[model samples]
Target: MGREYRCRIQGGPDRDAIRQLREGIRLDGQVSRFERIRHQGGRGANRWYEVVVCEGRYREIRRMWSAVGCRVNRLIRTRYGDLVLPRSLKAGQLRELNRAEVKALLRSVDVSHSGRRSSASSA
Candidate 1:
């Protein structure tokens, strides 16, 4: 697993397209744990989706939605490895993880030590 995203998307992809997406999406890596959480009240039939994907492939989420004829209105990184973004945080904010959390996050990627600090450390 890599970055987990909670995204708000609009546009109504028909059943077939939904099924196609549910089957799997081929980005840089496979899109996993893809699920529509709920219909958030907004214009354009906005809905939320949770998905897990490894590696960034240049706006891969937008590309994935576009492939299914959907439009992503908002995309937020909810989790990375075992680290979950706290709800208490607001937009454009950051938080430092605890030692245990840091360890868990590192373990998730099978890295005991990374030469560079991770952006996940200040999420």
Candidate 2:
């Protein structure tokens, strides 16, 4: 599973570029899930707008945008796994999850059911 990110970027990318992204492009390995959000004045590849991606590959977002010729001005992760970052949370503030929240998050992944063990795990 991959994390979801909403990006606000500078530079404009057009339909063909966006489609190429959604269809999948090779970043580090491969990255997909590119969605261009609709904004009031959004038209061509020169405005700041939102693009959503769901891939946690190393530097995938920035690299992907750069590949398509868009410069990411801002990147925000609104969701990770089953946890959603609250809108009320302010910048530079940290919130520790309560015990229950932590447990729920761990449970959401079901690591125990992933029977294949790595060499480190087998040791």
lDDT of each: 0.70, 0.66
Q: For residues 1-123, what per-residue lDDT tens digits would candidate 1 score against the true structure? A: 567787788876677776766666776565632443333345558877676666546787778878888998888888766788887888899888888987787676655475555566545
Model number with the top TM-score: 1
Give per-model TM-scores. 0.68, 0.66
**Runs with alpha carbons beyond 4 Å of true place in candidate 2:** 29-55, 88-93, 112-123
Q: What local lDDT score does residue 111 receive in model 1, on the 0 to 100 scale?
A: 59
**Candidate 1 CA-lDDT value:** 0.70
lDDT of 2 by residue, 1-123 (tens): 446666666776788777777777776564555644433244355454545555466777788878888887767776666788887877787799987777667566543335443455456
Measured on C-alpha atoms, candidate 2 has an lDDT of: 0.66
The runs of at least 3 residues in candidate 1 whose Cα sits more than 4 Å from the true structure, single-residue gaps closed, are 25-44, 113-123
- Lowest lDDT 10-residue stretch of candidate 1: 32-41
